[model samples]
Target: MKVLAARRRDAEDIRFLIDHLGLTNAEQVLALCGKVFPEEEMPGRARLVLGDIFDDS
Candidate 1:
C-alpha cells in the first residue's frame, strides 16, 4: 500500500511513520480511507483489520 500521509517521521536511516495529522489510530485511518476509496469499503476494512502501529511497535 502507498499512503501519502500529510506528515512523516524517520530516523537516521529508518522510516518511522507515514501518517495523517490528527488521525493517529486504526479507526480514524479507516474512516479516511473510506473517503478516498468509497467503492472499495471492503479493502478499507482490511486496513482496519491490520491494526495499528506505534513508535515502539
Candidate 2:
C-alpha cells in the first residue's frame, strides 16, 4: 500500500545517500537516519547497520 511504497522510496533515498554522500562514521549515519526516519528510534540500530554497510577501516 502507500506506506510500503513510501518505505521503498525511503530505502532508495538512503542507498543513494550512502553511495554518494561519503558518510564516514556512525554519527553521520545517525544524523541522516534521524532526518530520514524520524518516527523510529534508530541510533543504536543505525550504528550497527552502518558498520555493516560502510567501513572506512
Candidate 3:
C-alpha cells in the first residue's frame, strides 16, 4: 500500500538524518524528528522505525 511505502520512506529519511547528521543517540534522533515532523503522524512513524532500528542488540 502507499501508506506503507511512505512509512518506509520516512524511516529511511530518519535513518539518513541520524547517520548523516552524526546523531548517535536515539533520544537525539527523536528530537530531530520532532523538528522535522511536527505533525502527529510522521513523528509517530519515525518513532516506530527508530525504535526498531535503534533497539538493543
Best candidate (score: TM-score) = 3
**Model 3 Cα lDDT, one tens digit per residue, 1-57:** 222233765655656656778877777865665576666344355556667666732
Q: Which is better, 2 or 3, measured by lDDT?
A: 3
Assess the local accuracy of residue 9 in candidate 2 as a C-alpha lDDT between 0 and 100.
Answer: 36
Higher-scoring candidate on TM-score, 1 or 2: 2
Off by over 4 Å in 3: 1-6, 35-42
lDDT, model 2, position 24: 72
lDDT per residue for candidate 2 within 1-57, as digits (tens), equals 111133433544555566677867657767766787788766344445455555534
Candidate 2 all-Cα RMSD: 6.1
TM-score of each: 0.43, 0.47, 0.51
TM-score of 2: 0.47
Q: Candidate 1: misplaced stretches above 4 Å? A: 1-20, 44-52, 55-57
The true-versus-predicted C-alpha distance at residue 19 of model 1, in Å, is 3.1
Question: What TM-score would you give candidate 3 relative to the actual structure?
Answer: 0.51
Check candidate 1 and list the clashing pairs: none
Question: Model 2, residue 4: what's the lDDT?
Answer: 18
**Candidate 2 clash figure, as a count:** 0
In terms of TM-score, how similar is model 1 to the real structure?
Answer: 0.43
Q: What's the lDDT for candidate 2?
A: 0.54
